[model samples]
Target: MKGVMRFGKKGKLSPRFIGPFDILERMGTLAYRVAFPSNLTEFHNVFHLSMMQKYMSNPSHVLNYEPLQLTPHLSFEEKPTQIRDMQEKRLRNKVIQMVKVKCMNHSKEEATWETATEMRSRYPELFGTF
Candidate 1:
């Protein structure tokens, strides 16, 4: 997770919060040991409280998917799957056309706003001819 995770969307997408892992025991006043699954055994189990979040039981977390394909450096390209909407963004002395883009690996609620020209250029199929 070094540097900002650029999905290559050319946008400043925020970093993702990965887990709500089980806290096994308190290591000290500021740290706790967490239960790590076999796949994450390479990482240290103890972490500072500042680096962890409290686990809240959630019922909507049922679906599972395969791990994302990443390069040896651990990054992936974010491709727009569909253009959901379009509108004009008004700025002082200017108006910019924008597209509501639904990207792969994200839900409808996570769709983002991107410049229409950029989207059309990067994903011509979404725009067809012009």
Candidate 2:
């Protein structure tokens, strides 16, 4: 049997899948989580990268409920400058640090993903408050 197709208002993408990272584009996260709940750190990495990719586009409206921005290109075509390269490098470093702090590490790098999950599970009053 064929199934019926549904769409969002005014031809916009489905809102059921929109979010801080346009979860539609990231359909793999839930599957990964189900497959490997222990790999929360890997999932965290994926989520952070998705978010950074979204922000790198610098969309005009985060609330648009649509994937409206194109991924930013690091280069145009021909010429390259040392200053531009350094700036790009710095931006990448900043993204890594943000992911490490906010999503993955949360402070201590030596802490394995298992340890982090244990902390979250154990200290339901502290980190679990989120």
Candidate 3:
């Protein structure tokens, strides 16, 4: 329930629920032993009931299960695919540049706007030859 890092300063984008794993047994009044997928074997199987939610058994909500491709840190990467747009804003003597980046596995509607300097530094390959 608490392993994942809280994104940004406010934890606004952090995931609320991780899984709907099967409960193996009840450890106590407030604790439960749950079974996790083989891919998530690194994490402990036991969890507090407060950290879990009762999954609604809706057949229509089920999707094809694809085993997650995790990094060493147990996180997935969202690679930048292309720069959709670039813009510059001038304020007095300062000029700020921004770019809309399209990421792999994401749609154009989900493209995020980021500072040009940050994009250049983090993913220089996207810009190519400055």
TM-score top scorer: 1
lDDT digits (tens) for residues 28-113 of candidate 2: 63322122222121323233333233345555755543332211331111111111111111363452111111212111322212
Q: Per-residue lDDT of 12-87 in model 3, one digit per residue for the tens? A: 2233445467789999899999888887887778888777888778878964444445556656555678898999
Question: Who is ahead in lDDT, 1 or 3?
Answer: 3
Candidate 3 runs further than 4 Å off: 1-14, 64-66, 71-95, 98-113, 124-130
Choose the strongest candidate by lDDT.
3
RMSD of every prediction: 5.1, 22.0, 5.8
Which scores higher on TM-score, 1 or 2? 1
Task: Give every collision pair in model 1.
Answer: none
The number of residue pairs in model 2 that clash at the backbone is 0
Superior by TM-score: candidate 2 or candidate 3: 3
Candidate 1: lDDT of 4?
A: 28
- Candidate 2 pairs with clashing backbones: none
TM-score of each: 0.60, 0.14, 0.54
